[model samples]
Target: MSKKERKLSAAEQRRKEKFLEKCSTMETEGYRMENLSFSVLQINLLSVFIALPVNFLFMFSYFLFNDFSLRSVYLPYAPLLFLLIFLLLIVVHEAIHGITWGYFAPDGRKSIEYGVIWQALTPYCTCSSPLTKKQYFWGALMPTIILGFLPGIIAIITGWEPLFFVSQFMILAGAGDFLIVARLLLHRPKNAQVIYLDHPYECGLVAFLKNID
Candidate 1:
Protein backbone atom coordinates (compact mmCIF):
# COMPACT_ATOMS: atom_id res chain seq x y z
CA MET A 1 0.00 0.00 0.00
CA SER A 2 1.15 3.59 -0.59
CA LYS A 3 2.38 5.34 2.53
CA LYS A 4 0.02 7.90 4.03
CA GLU A 5 0.96 11.46 3.16
CA ARG A 6 2.70 13.17 6.01
CA LYS A 7 1.12 16.35 7.29
CA LEU A 8 3.20 19.50 7.69
CA SER A 9 4.12 20.65 11.15
CA ALA A 10 2.66 23.92 12.44
CA ALA A 11 5.78 25.88 11.61
CA GLU A 12 6.13 24.35 8.17
CA GLN A 13 2.45 24.99 7.46
CA ARG A 14 2.77 28.59 8.55
CA ARG A 15 5.83 29.07 6.33
CA LYS A 16 3.98 27.69 3.34
CA GLU A 17 0.99 29.91 4.12
CA LYS A 18 3.24 32.94 4.37
CA PHE A 19 4.83 32.22 0.98
CA LEU A 20 1.42 31.77 -0.60
CA GLU A 21 0.20 35.00 0.93
CA LYS A 22 3.21 36.79 -0.49
CA CYS A 23 2.51 35.30 -3.90
CA SER A 24 -1.08 36.47 -3.75
CA THR A 25 0.00 39.98 -2.80
CA MET A 26 2.51 40.05 -5.65
CA GLU A 27 -0.09 38.96 -8.20
CA THR A 28 -2.59 41.47 -6.93
CA GLU A 29 0.03 44.16 -7.28
CA GLY A 30 0.52 43.26 -10.95
CA TYR A 31 3.75 41.42 -10.44
CA ARG A 32 4.16 38.07 -12.14
CA MET A 33 5.85 35.13 -10.44
CA GLU A 34 8.58 33.05 -12.04
CA ASN A 35 10.36 30.25 -10.26
CA LEU A 36 13.73 28.88 -11.36
CA SER A 37 15.12 25.98 -9.44
CA PHE A 38 18.67 24.63 -9.71
CA SER A 39 20.04 21.80 -7.68
CA VAL A 40 23.40 22.06 -5.91
CA LEU A 41 24.96 19.51 -8.22
CA GLN A 42 23.73 21.32 -11.30
CA ILE A 43 25.17 24.62 -10.13
CA ASN A 44 28.52 23.05 -9.38
CA LEU A 45 28.62 21.31 -12.71
CA LEU A 46 27.79 24.51 -14.53
CA SER A 47 30.48 26.33 -12.61
CA VAL A 48 33.02 23.75 -13.69
CA PHE A 49 32.02 24.09 -17.31
CA ILE A 50 32.23 27.88 -17.17
CA ALA A 51 35.47 28.02 -15.26
CA LEU A 52 37.42 25.70 -17.53
CA PRO A 53 37.17 27.82 -20.65
CA VAL A 54 37.58 31.06 -18.75
CA ASN A 55 40.69 29.76 -17.07
CA PHE A 56 42.07 28.57 -20.36
CA LEU A 57 41.47 31.89 -22.05
CA PHE A 58 43.02 33.87 -19.24
CA MET A 59 46.05 31.58 -19.18
CA PHE A 60 46.41 31.76 -22.92
CA SER A 61 46.16 35.52 -22.93
CA TYR A 62 48.72 35.84 -20.18
CA PHE A 63 51.09 33.63 -22.10
CA LEU A 64 50.55 35.47 -25.34
CA PHE A 65 50.86 38.96 -23.89
CA ASN A 66 53.86 38.32 -21.65
CA ASP A 67 57.24 36.73 -22.37
CA PHE A 68 57.29 34.47 -19.30
CA SER A 69 56.40 30.80 -19.03
CA LEU A 70 53.34 29.71 -17.02
CA ARG A 71 55.71 28.33 -14.42
CA SER A 72 56.64 31.85 -13.43
CA VAL A 73 53.40 32.28 -11.51
CA TYR A 74 53.32 28.94 -9.78
CA LEU A 75 53.79 29.19 -6.04
CA PRO A 76 55.66 26.43 -4.24
CA TYR A 77 52.98 25.59 -1.68
CA ALA A 78 51.77 22.30 -0.30
CA PRO A 79 48.47 20.94 -1.60
CA LEU A 80 47.00 21.00 1.92
CA LEU A 81 47.74 24.70 2.24
CA PHE A 82 46.04 25.41 -1.04
CA LEU A 83 42.98 23.43 0.01
CA LEU A 84 42.73 25.23 3.36
CA ILE A 85 43.09 28.59 1.71
CA PHE A 86 40.41 27.78 -0.82
CA LEU A 87 38.04 26.71 1.95
CA LEU A 88 38.59 29.98 3.78
CA LEU A 89 37.99 31.94 0.60
CA ILE A 90 34.69 30.10 0.17
CA VAL A 91 33.51 31.48 3.50
CA VAL A 92 34.70 34.92 2.49
CA HIS A 93 32.84 34.58 -0.79
CA GLU A 94 29.50 34.11 0.99
CA ALA A 95 30.35 36.89 3.40
CA ILE A 96 30.97 39.20 0.44
CA HIS A 97 27.51 38.39 -0.91
CA GLY A 98 25.88 39.15 2.43
CA ILE A 99 27.79 42.35 2.96
CA THR A 100 27.11 43.67 -0.52
CA TRP A 101 23.43 42.73 -0.48
CA GLY A 102 23.04 44.18 2.99
CA TYR A 103 24.34 47.51 1.76
CA PHE A 104 21.31 48.03 -0.45
CA ALA A 105 18.73 46.03 1.46
CA PRO A 106 15.78 48.05 2.76
CA ASP A 107 16.31 46.89 6.32
CA GLY A 108 20.05 47.23 5.92
CA ARG A 109 22.20 44.35 7.09
CA LYS A 110 19.37 42.83 9.11
CA SER A 111 17.49 42.01 5.95
CA ILE A 112 20.30 39.76 4.77
CA GLU A 113 20.08 36.18 5.95
CA TYR A 114 22.75 33.49 5.78
CA GLY A 115 22.12 29.78 5.99
CA VAL A 116 22.98 26.41 4.58
CA ILE A 117 20.87 24.06 2.52
CA TRP A 118 20.90 20.85 4.48
CA GLN A 119 20.24 18.53 1.58
CA ALA A 120 22.79 20.15 -0.71
CA LEU A 121 25.20 21.17 2.03
CA THR A 122 25.62 24.51 0.30
CA PRO A 123 25.85 27.86 2.00
CA TYR A 124 23.87 30.88 0.83
CA CYS A 125 23.34 34.55 1.52
CA THR A 126 19.98 36.00 0.62
CA CYS A 127 18.16 39.25 1.16
CA SER A 128 14.89 38.89 3.07
CA SER A 129 13.22 41.82 1.32
CA PRO A 130 13.04 42.81 -2.31
CA LEU A 131 15.50 45.28 -3.88
CA THR A 132 15.53 47.49 -6.95
CA LYS A 133 16.90 46.04 -10.14
CA LYS A 134 20.03 48.16 -10.05
CA GLN A 135 20.67 47.44 -6.41
CA TYR A 136 20.03 43.76 -6.87
CA PHE A 137 22.30 43.64 -9.86
CA TRP A 138 25.17 45.22 -8.01
CA GLY A 139 24.63 42.98 -5.02
CA ALA A 140 24.51 39.92 -7.22
CA LEU A 141 27.61 40.81 -9.18
CA MET A 142 29.81 42.32 -6.48
CA PRO A 143 31.35 39.12 -5.21
CA THR A 144 32.08 37.96 -8.71
CA ILE A 145 33.86 41.17 -9.54
CA ILE A 146 35.60 41.82 -6.27
CA LEU A 147 36.60 38.28 -5.45
CA GLY A 148 36.79 36.79 -8.89
CA PHE A 149 37.40 38.95 -11.93
CA LEU A 150 39.20 41.80 -10.25
CA PRO A 151 41.65 39.62 -8.41
CA GLY A 152 42.14 37.51 -11.45
CA ILE A 153 42.98 40.55 -13.50
CA ILE A 154 45.36 41.85 -10.89
CA ALA A 155 47.02 38.46 -10.65
CA ILE A 156 47.47 38.27 -14.35
CA ILE A 157 49.04 41.72 -14.39
CA THR A 158 51.35 41.05 -11.47
CA GLY A 159 52.12 37.47 -12.52
CA TRP A 160 50.76 36.05 -9.28
CA GLU A 161 49.77 32.53 -10.25
CA PRO A 162 48.22 31.52 -6.95
CA LEU A 163 45.90 34.50 -6.74
CA PHE A 164 44.99 34.13 -10.41
CA PHE A 165 44.01 30.51 -9.90
CA VAL A 166 41.96 31.34 -6.81
CA SER A 167 40.22 34.16 -8.61
CA GLN A 168 39.33 31.91 -11.53
CA PHE A 169 37.88 29.43 -9.08
CA MET A 170 35.76 32.23 -7.63
CA ILE A 171 34.47 33.08 -11.07
CA LEU A 172 33.36 29.51 -11.45
CA ALA A 173 31.88 29.65 -7.98
CA GLY A 174 29.69 32.54 -9.09
CA ALA A 175 28.00 30.69 -11.92
CA GLY A 176 24.75 30.73 -10.00
CA ASP A 177 24.83 34.51 -9.73
CA PHE A 178 25.44 34.81 -13.46
CA LEU A 179 22.42 32.59 -14.03
CA ILE A 180 20.26 34.85 -11.85
CA VAL A 181 21.48 37.92 -13.68
CA ALA A 182 20.64 36.39 -17.02
CA ARG A 183 17.13 35.52 -15.86
CA LEU A 184 16.59 39.01 -14.52
CA LEU A 185 17.66 40.58 -17.78
CA LEU A 186 15.48 38.25 -19.82
CA HIS A 187 12.26 38.86 -17.85
CA ARG A 188 12.79 42.44 -16.83
CA PRO A 189 10.07 44.86 -17.87
CA LYS A 190 10.86 48.01 -19.78
CA ASN A 191 10.30 51.36 -18.04
CA ALA A 192 9.25 49.61 -14.85
CA GLN A 193 10.78 49.34 -11.44
CA VAL A 194 12.06 45.87 -10.70
CA ILE A 195 12.73 44.16 -7.41
CA TYR A 196 13.76 40.62 -6.52
CA LEU A 197 13.38 38.40 -3.49
CA ASP A 198 15.46 35.33 -2.86
CA HIS A 199 13.63 32.06 -2.74
CA PRO A 200 13.77 30.72 0.81
CA TYR A 201 14.57 27.11 -0.04
CA GLU A 202 15.54 27.17 -3.69
CA CYS A 203 18.58 28.19 -5.69
CA GLY A 204 16.72 31.04 -7.34
CA LEU A 205 14.77 34.26 -6.71
CA VAL A 206 11.43 35.93 -7.47
CA ALA A 207 11.28 39.05 -9.56
CA PHE A 208 8.59 41.71 -9.06
CA LEU A 209 7.94 44.43 -11.57
CA LYS A 210 6.09 47.65 -10.82
CA ASN A 211 4.85 49.11 -14.05
CA ILE A 212 5.23 52.84 -14.43
CA ASP A 213 1.61 53.52 -15.15
Candidate 2:
Protein backbone atom coordinates (compact mmCIF):
# COMPACT_ATOMS: atom_id res chain seq x y z
CA MET A 1 0.00 0.00 0.00
CA SER A 2 1.35 3.42 -0.95
CA LYS A 3 1.27 6.65 1.10
CA LYS A 4 -1.57 7.98 -1.05
CA GLU A 5 -3.59 4.80 -0.49
CA ARG A 6 -2.69 4.90 3.23
CA LYS A 7 -4.09 8.39 3.87
CA LEU A 8 -7.53 7.66 2.50
CA SER A 9 -8.84 5.04 4.92
CA ALA A 10 -7.46 4.98 8.48
CA ALA A 11 -9.10 1.62 9.20
CA GLU A 12 -7.71 0.16 5.99
CA GLN A 13 -4.33 1.67 6.88
CA ARG A 14 -4.42 -0.14 10.21
CA ARG A 15 -5.16 -3.39 8.44
CA LYS A 16 -2.36 -2.63 5.99
CA GLU A 17 0.05 -2.07 8.91
CA LYS A 18 -0.83 -5.41 10.46
CA PHE A 19 -0.49 -7.21 7.15
CA LEU A 20 2.88 -5.59 6.46
CA GLU A 21 4.25 -7.13 9.67
CA LYS A 22 2.87 -10.46 8.66
CA CYS A 23 4.41 -10.11 5.21
CA SER A 24 7.79 -9.28 6.75
CA THR A 25 7.70 -12.40 8.89
CA MET A 26 6.69 -14.49 5.88
CA GLU A 27 9.44 -12.91 3.77
CA THR A 28 11.99 -14.14 6.29
CA GLU A 29 10.47 -17.61 5.80
CA GLY A 30 10.94 -17.26 2.01
CA TYR A 31 7.58 -15.96 0.92
CA ARG A 32 7.11 -12.95 -1.32
CA MET A 33 4.04 -10.72 -1.20
CA GLU A 34 2.84 -8.19 -3.73
CA ASN A 35 -0.12 -5.95 -4.33
CA LEU A 36 -2.30 -7.64 -6.96
CA SER A 37 -5.06 -5.13 -6.53
CA PHE A 38 -6.89 -2.98 -9.08
CA SER A 39 -8.32 0.47 -8.52
CA VAL A 40 -12.09 1.06 -8.15
CA LEU A 41 -12.29 2.79 -11.52
CA GLN A 42 -10.56 -0.07 -13.28
CA ILE A 43 -12.89 -2.65 -11.79
CA ASN A 44 -15.93 -0.61 -12.71
CA LEU A 45 -14.77 -0.17 -16.28
CA LEU A 46 -13.75 -3.79 -16.63
CA SER A 47 -17.13 -4.91 -15.39
CA VAL A 48 -18.93 -3.35 -18.35
CA PHE A 49 -16.82 -5.07 -21.00
CA ILE A 50 -16.88 -8.37 -19.14
CA ALA A 51 -20.65 -8.31 -18.85
CA LEU A 52 -21.24 -7.58 -22.53
CA PRO A 53 -20.15 -10.85 -24.09
CA VAL A 54 -21.82 -12.97 -21.45
CA ASN A 55 -25.18 -11.22 -21.76
CA PHE A 56 -24.89 -11.04 -25.51
CA LEU A 57 -24.13 -14.73 -25.93
CA PHE A 58 -26.98 -15.81 -23.70
CA MET A 59 -29.40 -13.30 -25.16
CA PHE A 60 -28.50 -14.13 -28.72
CA SER A 61 -28.84 -17.86 -28.21
CA TYR A 62 -32.12 -17.50 -26.39
CA PHE A 63 -33.55 -15.36 -29.14
CA LEU A 64 -32.52 -17.83 -31.81
CA PHE A 65 -34.94 -20.42 -30.47
CA ASN A 66 -37.35 -18.37 -28.40
CA ASP A 67 -39.18 -15.04 -28.22
CA PHE A 68 -37.98 -12.17 -26.07
CA SER A 69 -40.45 -12.90 -23.36
CA LEU A 70 -40.47 -11.04 -20.09
CA ARG A 71 -43.59 -12.83 -18.94
CA SER A 72 -43.18 -16.52 -19.27
CA VAL A 73 -45.70 -17.07 -16.54
CA TYR A 74 -48.32 -15.06 -14.69
CA LEU A 75 -47.93 -13.95 -11.08
CA PRO A 76 -49.87 -11.55 -8.95
CA TYR A 77 -48.36 -8.06 -9.29
CA ALA A 78 -45.68 -9.40 -11.61
CA PRO A 79 -43.58 -6.28 -11.89
CA LEU A 80 -43.52 -5.69 -8.13
CA LEU A 81 -42.63 -9.32 -7.48
CA PHE A 82 -39.90 -9.25 -10.09
CA LEU A 83 -38.47 -6.16 -8.41
CA LEU A 84 -38.63 -7.86 -5.01
CA ILE A 85 -36.80 -10.94 -6.22
CA PHE A 86 -34.21 -8.81 -7.91
CA LEU A 87 -33.39 -7.07 -4.63
CA LEU A 88 -33.41 -10.35 -2.73
CA LEU A 89 -30.98 -12.03 -5.13
CA ILE A 90 -28.52 -9.20 -4.64
CA VAL A 91 -28.32 -10.07 -0.96
CA VAL A 92 -28.00 -13.75 -1.79
CA HIS A 93 -25.08 -12.99 -4.10
CA GLU A 94 -23.10 -11.36 -1.31
CA ALA A 95 -24.09 -14.05 1.16
CA ILE A 96 -22.71 -16.70 -1.17
CA HIS A 97 -19.39 -14.82 -1.25
CA GLY A 98 -19.22 -14.62 2.53
CA ILE A 99 -20.31 -18.19 3.02
CA THR A 100 -17.92 -19.71 0.51
CA TRP A 101 -14.92 -17.68 1.68
CA GLY A 102 -15.77 -18.18 5.36
CA TYR A 103 -15.82 -21.93 4.83
CA PHE A 104 -12.17 -21.76 3.75
CA ALA A 105 -11.01 -18.96 6.03
CA PRO A 106 -8.51 -19.92 8.75
CA ASP A 107 -10.79 -18.35 11.34
CA GLY A 108 -13.85 -19.71 9.55
CA ARG A 109 -16.91 -17.55 9.89
CA LYS A 110 -15.18 -15.29 12.40
CA SER A 111 -13.06 -13.79 9.64
CA ILE A 112 -15.97 -13.02 7.34
CA GLU A 113 -17.65 -9.65 7.03
CA TYR A 114 -20.52 -8.21 5.00
CA GLY A 115 -20.76 -4.55 4.10
CA VAL A 116 -22.29 -2.16 1.63
CA ILE A 117 -20.61 0.65 -0.27
CA TRP A 118 -23.14 3.39 0.30
CA GLN A 119 -21.75 5.66 -2.38
CA ALA A 120 -22.24 3.10 -5.15
CA LEU A 121 -24.87 1.04 -3.33
CA THR A 122 -22.86 -2.10 -3.87
CA PRO A 123 -22.97 -4.93 -1.36
CA TYR A 124 -19.85 -6.99 -0.78
CA CYS A 125 -18.48 -9.75 1.40
CA THR A 126 -14.90 -10.09 2.48
CA CYS A 127 -12.75 -12.69 4.18
CA SER A 128 -9.91 -11.38 6.27
CA SER A 129 -7.97 -14.63 6.33
CA PRO A 130 -5.71 -15.84 3.55
CA LEU A 131 -6.94 -18.59 1.24
CA THR A 132 -5.35 -21.22 -0.90
CA LYS A 133 -5.73 -20.93 -4.68
CA LYS A 134 -8.46 -23.55 -4.92
CA GLN A 135 -10.38 -22.06 -2.04
CA TYR A 136 -10.10 -18.54 -3.38
CA PHE A 137 -11.20 -19.52 -6.86
CA TRP A 138 -14.36 -21.19 -5.67
CA GLY A 139 -15.28 -18.42 -3.25
CA ALA A 140 -14.77 -15.90 -5.98
CA LEU A 141 -16.75 -17.92 -8.48
CA MET A 142 -19.60 -19.85 -6.86
CA PRO A 143 -22.08 -16.99 -7.00
CA THR A 144 -21.68 -16.57 -10.72
CA ILE A 145 -22.03 -20.29 -11.16
CA ILE A 146 -24.89 -20.93 -8.81
CA LEU A 147 -27.07 -17.87 -9.28
CA GLY A 148 -25.98 -16.81 -12.71
CA PHE A 149 -24.86 -19.49 -15.13
CA LEU A 150 -26.83 -22.36 -13.73
CA PRO A 151 -30.12 -20.58 -13.84
CA GLY A 152 -29.29 -18.80 -17.05
CA ILE A 153 -28.48 -22.06 -18.76
CA ILE A 154 -31.66 -23.59 -17.45
CA ALA A 155 -33.63 -20.61 -18.70
CA ILE A 156 -32.10 -20.88 -22.13
CA ILE A 157 -33.03 -24.50 -22.40
CA THR A 158 -36.44 -24.30 -20.80
CA GLY A 159 -37.53 -20.93 -22.23
CA TRP A 160 -38.16 -19.23 -18.92
CA GLU A 161 -37.73 -15.50 -19.39
CA PRO A 162 -37.80 -14.50 -15.73
CA LEU A 163 -35.10 -16.96 -14.80
CA PHE A 164 -33.07 -15.94 -17.85
CA PHE A 165 -33.20 -12.23 -17.08
CA VAL A 166 -32.50 -12.67 -13.38
CA SER A 167 -29.59 -14.98 -14.05
CA GLN A 168 -28.09 -12.77 -16.76
CA PHE A 169 -28.42 -9.72 -14.54
CA MET A 170 -26.72 -11.52 -11.68
CA ILE A 171 -23.96 -12.56 -14.05
CA LEU A 172 -23.53 -8.94 -15.07
CA ALA A 173 -23.55 -7.93 -11.44
CA GLY A 174 -20.72 -10.36 -10.74
CA ALA A 175 -18.54 -9.07 -13.58
CA GLY A 176 -16.16 -7.36 -11.16
CA ASP A 177 -15.71 -10.61 -9.31
CA PHE A 178 -15.19 -12.46 -12.59
CA LEU A 179 -12.43 -9.98 -13.46
CA ILE A 180 -10.75 -10.65 -10.14
CA VAL A 181 -10.97 -14.35 -10.74
CA ALA A 182 -9.56 -13.86 -14.21
CA ARG A 183 -6.60 -12.06 -12.71
CA LEU A 184 -5.83 -15.05 -10.55
CA LEU A 185 -6.20 -17.35 -13.50
CA LEU A 186 -3.94 -15.37 -15.84
CA HIS A 187 -1.19 -14.10 -13.55
CA ARG A 188 -0.31 -17.10 -11.42
CA PRO A 189 3.31 -17.22 -10.24
CA LYS A 190 5.41 -20.06 -11.61
CA ASN A 191 6.58 -22.82 -9.20
CA ALA A 192 5.05 -21.09 -6.22
CA GLN A 193 2.42 -22.00 -3.70
CA VAL A 194 0.05 -19.08 -3.76
CA ILE A 195 -2.27 -17.48 -1.24
CA TYR A 196 -4.78 -14.70 -1.80
CA LEU A 197 -6.25 -12.33 0.71
CA ASP A 198 -9.27 -10.08 0.29
CA HIS A 199 -8.37 -6.42 -0.09
CA PRO A 200 -10.35 -4.25 2.28
CA TYR A 201 -10.17 -0.98 0.38
CA GLU A 202 -10.67 -2.22 -3.18
CA CYS A 203 -12.30 -4.85 -5.35
CA GLY A 204 -9.08 -6.83 -5.50
CA LEU A 205 -6.80 -9.22 -3.67
CA VAL A 206 -3.27 -9.42 -2.23
CA ALA A 207 -1.10 -12.31 -3.36
CA PHE A 208 1.62 -14.15 -1.48
CA LEU A 209 3.87 -16.58 -3.27
CA LYS A 210 6.27 -19.14 -1.83
CA ASN A 211 8.56 -21.12 -4.05
CA ILE A 212 8.02 -24.86 -4.03
CA ASP A 213 10.81 -27.15 -2.84
Candidate 3:
Protein backbone atom coordinates (compact mmCIF):
# COMPACT_ATOMS: atom_id res chain seq x y z
CA MET A 1 0.00 0.00 0.00
CA SER A 2 1.10 3.56 -0.75
CA LYS A 3 1.16 6.28 1.87
CA LYS A 4 -1.53 8.95 1.47
CA GLU A 5 -0.73 12.62 1.59
CA ARG A 6 -2.19 14.65 4.42
CA LYS A 7 -4.27 17.70 3.69
CA LEU A 8 -4.64 20.78 5.86
CA SER A 9 -8.06 21.65 7.19
CA ALA A 10 -9.74 24.85 6.00
CA ALA A 11 -8.97 26.71 9.19
CA GLU A 12 -5.37 25.57 9.10
CA GLN A 13 -5.08 26.65 5.49
CA ARG A 14 -6.50 30.06 6.31
CA ARG A 15 -4.00 30.49 9.12
CA LYS A 16 -1.17 29.52 6.79
CA GLU A 17 -2.36 31.99 4.20
CA LYS A 18 -2.74 34.74 6.76
CA PHE A 19 0.80 34.32 7.97
CA LEU A 20 2.18 34.27 4.48
CA GLU A 21 0.24 37.38 3.51
CA LYS A 22 1.59 39.17 6.55
CA CYS A 23 5.10 38.19 5.59
CA SER A 24 4.56 39.48 2.09
CA THR A 25 3.12 42.75 3.30
CA MET A 26 5.99 43.23 5.70
CA GLU A 27 8.62 42.67 3.05
CA THR A 28 6.96 45.11 0.69
CA GLU A 29 6.78 47.65 3.47
CA GLY A 30 10.52 47.27 4.19
CA TYR A 31 9.82 45.47 7.45
CA ARG A 32 12.04 42.79 8.88
CA MET A 33 11.34 39.78 11.04
CA GLU A 34 13.41 38.43 13.90
CA ASN A 35 12.90 35.26 15.86
CA LEU A 36 14.05 33.61 19.06
CA SER A 37 14.04 29.92 19.74
CA PHE A 38 14.59 27.76 22.82
CA SER A 39 13.85 24.21 23.86
CA VAL A 40 11.22 23.42 26.45
CA LEU A 41 13.71 22.21 29.05
CA GLN A 42 15.94 25.21 28.47
CA ILE A 43 13.05 27.63 28.97
CA ASN A 44 11.80 25.88 32.11
CA LEU A 45 15.27 25.86 33.67
CA LEU A 46 15.83 29.47 32.74
CA SER A 47 12.48 30.39 34.25
CA VAL A 48 13.47 28.77 37.56
CA PHE A 49 16.59 30.89 37.87
CA ILE A 50 14.79 34.07 36.87
CA ALA A 51 11.84 33.33 39.14
CA LEU A 52 13.91 32.85 42.32
CA PRO A 53 14.51 36.52 43.01
CA VAL A 54 11.04 37.53 41.88
CA ASN A 55 9.44 35.01 44.18
CA PHE A 56 11.74 36.13 46.99
CA LEU A 57 10.80 39.76 46.41
CA PHE A 58 7.13 38.95 46.61
CA MET A 59 7.70 37.04 49.85
CA PHE A 60 9.96 39.70 51.30
CA SER A 61 7.52 42.46 50.54
CA TYR A 62 4.70 40.49 52.08
CA PHE A 63 6.64 39.86 55.25
CA LEU A 64 7.68 43.49 55.41
CA PHE A 65 4.15 44.81 55.10
CA ASN A 66 2.39 42.32 57.38
CA ASP A 67 2.88 39.78 60.15
CA PHE A 68 4.87 36.75 59.12
CA SER A 69 4.39 33.33 60.61
CA LEU A 70 4.47 29.83 59.23
CA ARG A 71 1.43 27.70 59.75
CA SER A 72 0.47 24.26 58.44
CA VAL A 73 -2.35 24.49 55.89
CA TYR A 74 -2.00 20.89 54.78
CA LEU A 75 -4.26 18.19 56.21
CA PRO A 76 -3.61 14.45 56.52
CA TYR A 77 -5.52 13.60 53.29
CA ALA A 78 -4.85 16.89 51.48
CA PRO A 79 -1.76 15.80 49.57
CA LEU A 80 -3.72 14.06 46.84
CA LEU A 81 -6.26 16.85 46.70
CA PHE A 82 -3.56 19.48 46.49
CA LEU A 83 -1.86 17.55 43.72
CA LEU A 84 -5.08 17.42 41.74
CA ILE A 85 -5.70 21.11 42.26
CA PHE A 86 -2.18 21.92 41.12
CA LEU A 87 -2.68 19.93 37.93
CA LEU A 88 -5.96 21.67 37.22
CA LEU A 89 -4.36 25.05 37.80
CA ILE A 90 -1.72 24.25 35.23
CA VAL A 91 -4.42 23.84 32.60
CA VAL A 92 -5.96 27.08 33.74
CA HIS A 93 -2.60 28.74 33.31
CA GLU A 94 -2.50 27.86 29.61
CA ALA A 95 -6.14 28.76 29.19
CA ILE A 96 -5.38 32.19 30.54
CA HIS A 97 -2.87 32.69 27.75
CA GLY A 98 -5.45 31.79 25.16
CA ILE A 99 -8.17 33.88 26.71
CA THR A 100 -6.06 36.97 27.14
CA TRP A 101 -4.49 36.76 23.70
CA GLY A 102 -7.81 36.00 22.12
CA TYR A 103 -9.11 39.33 23.28
CA PHE A 104 -6.54 41.12 21.15
CA ALA A 105 -6.55 38.89 18.11
CA PRO A 106 -8.10 40.12 14.89
CA ASP A 107 -10.33 37.10 14.65
CA GLY A 108 -10.91 36.98 18.35
CA ARG A 109 -11.13 33.47 19.74
CA LYS A 110 -10.64 31.93 16.32
CA SER A 111 -7.16 33.37 16.18
CA ILE A 112 -5.82 31.32 19.07
CA GLU A 113 -4.40 27.86 18.59
CA TYR A 114 -3.65 25.47 21.44
CA GLY A 115 -1.49 22.40 21.13
CA VAL A 116 1.17 20.34 22.84
CA ILE A 117 4.75 19.68 21.85
CA TRP A 118 4.74 15.94 22.23
CA GLN A 119 8.50 15.58 22.44
CA ALA A 120 8.78 18.05 25.30
CA LEU A 121 5.41 17.27 26.82
CA THR A 122 4.66 20.98 26.97
CA PRO A 123 1.41 22.72 26.15
CA TYR A 124 1.33 26.02 24.28
CA CYS A 125 -1.13 28.65 23.10
CA THR A 126 -0.19 30.67 20.01
CA CYS A 127 -1.77 33.69 18.38
CA SER A 128 -2.18 33.37 14.63
CA SER A 129 -2.39 37.10 13.95
CA PRO A 130 -0.07 39.96 14.67
CA LEU A 131 -0.47 41.97 17.89
CA THR A 132 0.86 45.29 19.14
CA LYS A 133 3.82 45.19 21.48
CA LYS A 134 1.75 46.23 24.48
CA GLN A 135 -1.00 43.80 23.60
CA TYR A 136 1.42 40.95 23.22
CA PHE A 137 3.15 41.80 26.46
CA TRP A 138 -0.06 41.74 28.41
CA GLY A 139 -1.17 38.49 26.82
CA ALA A 140 2.15 36.88 27.59
CA LEU A 141 2.19 38.14 31.16
CA MET A 142 -1.47 37.81 32.13
CA PRO A 143 -1.19 34.28 33.44
CA THR A 144 1.79 35.19 35.58
CA ILE A 145 0.04 38.18 37.04
CA ILE A 146 -3.33 36.57 37.65
CA LEU A 147 -2.17 33.16 38.79
CA GLY A 148 1.09 34.14 40.50
CA PHE A 149 1.46 37.76 41.57
CA LEU A 150 -2.14 38.55 42.49
CA PRO A 151 -2.80 35.35 44.35
CA GLY A 152 0.58 35.54 46.03
CA ILE A 153 -0.18 39.04 47.24
CA ILE A 154 -3.54 37.98 48.59
CA ALA A 155 -1.95 34.97 50.22
CA ILE A 156 0.62 37.12 51.94
CA ILE A 157 -2.01 39.51 53.28
CA THR A 158 -4.24 36.70 54.46
CA GLY A 159 -1.47 34.25 55.48
CA TRP A 160 -2.75 31.57 53.16
CA GLU A 161 0.01 29.06 52.46
CA PRO A 162 -1.73 27.32 49.59
CA LEU A 163 -2.21 30.51 47.61
CA PHE A 164 1.34 31.59 48.31
CA PHE A 165 2.86 28.33 47.09
CA VAL A 166 0.64 28.09 44.02
CA SER A 167 1.38 31.68 43.06
CA GLN A 168 5.12 31.10 43.33
CA PHE A 169 4.84 28.11 41.04
CA MET A 170 2.87 30.15 38.48
CA ILE A 171 5.44 32.94 38.52
CA LEU A 172 8.18 30.42 37.92
CA ALA A 173 6.21 28.90 35.09
CA GLY A 174 5.99 32.34 33.46
CA ALA A 175 9.72 32.96 33.32
CA GLY A 176 9.83 32.38 29.58
CA ASP A 177 7.26 35.11 29.04
CA PHE A 178 9.34 37.57 31.02
CA LEU A 179 12.34 36.64 28.92
CA ILE A 180 10.39 37.28 25.73
CA VAL A 181 9.25 40.69 26.93
CA ALA A 182 12.79 41.58 27.83
CA ARG A 183 14.03 40.59 24.41
CA LEU A 184 11.36 42.71 22.76
CA LEU A 185 12.26 45.70 24.89
CA LEU A 186 15.93 45.36 24.10
CA HIS A 187 15.78 44.55 20.37
CA ARG A 188 12.54 45.96 19.03
CA PRO A 189 12.89 48.50 16.25
CA LYS A 190 12.66 52.18 17.07
CA ASN A 191 9.71 54.30 15.87
CA ALA A 192 7.95 51.37 14.35
CA GLN A 193 4.66 49.57 14.77
CA VAL A 194 5.73 46.31 16.32
CA ILE A 195 3.75 43.13 15.92
CA TYR A 196 4.48 39.84 17.64
CA LEU A 197 3.60 36.37 16.45
CA ASP A 198 3.80 33.59 18.96
CA HIS A 199 5.78 30.74 17.48
CA PRO A 200 3.66 27.68 16.88
CA TYR A 201 6.17 25.16 18.13
CA GLU A 202 9.13 26.99 19.64
CA CYS A 203 9.55 28.43 23.10
CA GLY A 204 9.93 32.00 21.86
CA LEU A 205 8.12 34.19 19.30
CA VAL A 206 8.85 36.15 16.14
CA ALA A 207 8.63 39.92 16.09
CA PHE A 208 7.89 42.01 13.00
CA LEU A 209 8.29 45.74 12.70
CA LYS A 210 7.08 48.35 10.22
CA ASN A 211 8.13 51.97 10.25
CA ILE A 212 5.53 54.67 10.82
CA ASP A 213 4.92 57.03 7.94
Best by TM-score: 2
Ten-residue region with minimum lDDT total, candidate 3: 1-10
What number of backbone clashes does candidate 1 have, counting pairs of residues 3 or more apart or in separate chains? Answer: 0
Question: 33, model 1: CA deviation in Å?
Answer: 1.5
Ranking by TM-score: 2, 3, 1
Per residue, candidate 3 scores C-alpha lDDT tens digits across 16-126 of 577778778888888887775455666767867778999899889777776655443356756676677777877888899899999999889988887665555667787
The true-structure Cα RMSD of candidate 1 reads 4.8
What are the Cα lDDT values of the candidates? 0.71, 0.81, 0.75
**lDDT measured at residue 71 in model 1 versus the true structure, 0 to 100:** 58
**Cα lDDT tens digits for candidate 2, 105-170:** 989998887776555566778788999878988999998899999998898899888888889888
Scored by lDDT, the top model is 2
Mind giving the per-residue lDDT tens digits that candidate 1 earns over 1-213?
Answer: 013323444543554466678889988989876665455566666756656777688777667665554452355664566678777877888888889889888788987767665555677886777777678778878888898888988887887776777787788778787877766667756787666776655566777666787
Q: What TM-score does model 1 achieve against the real structure?
A: 0.80
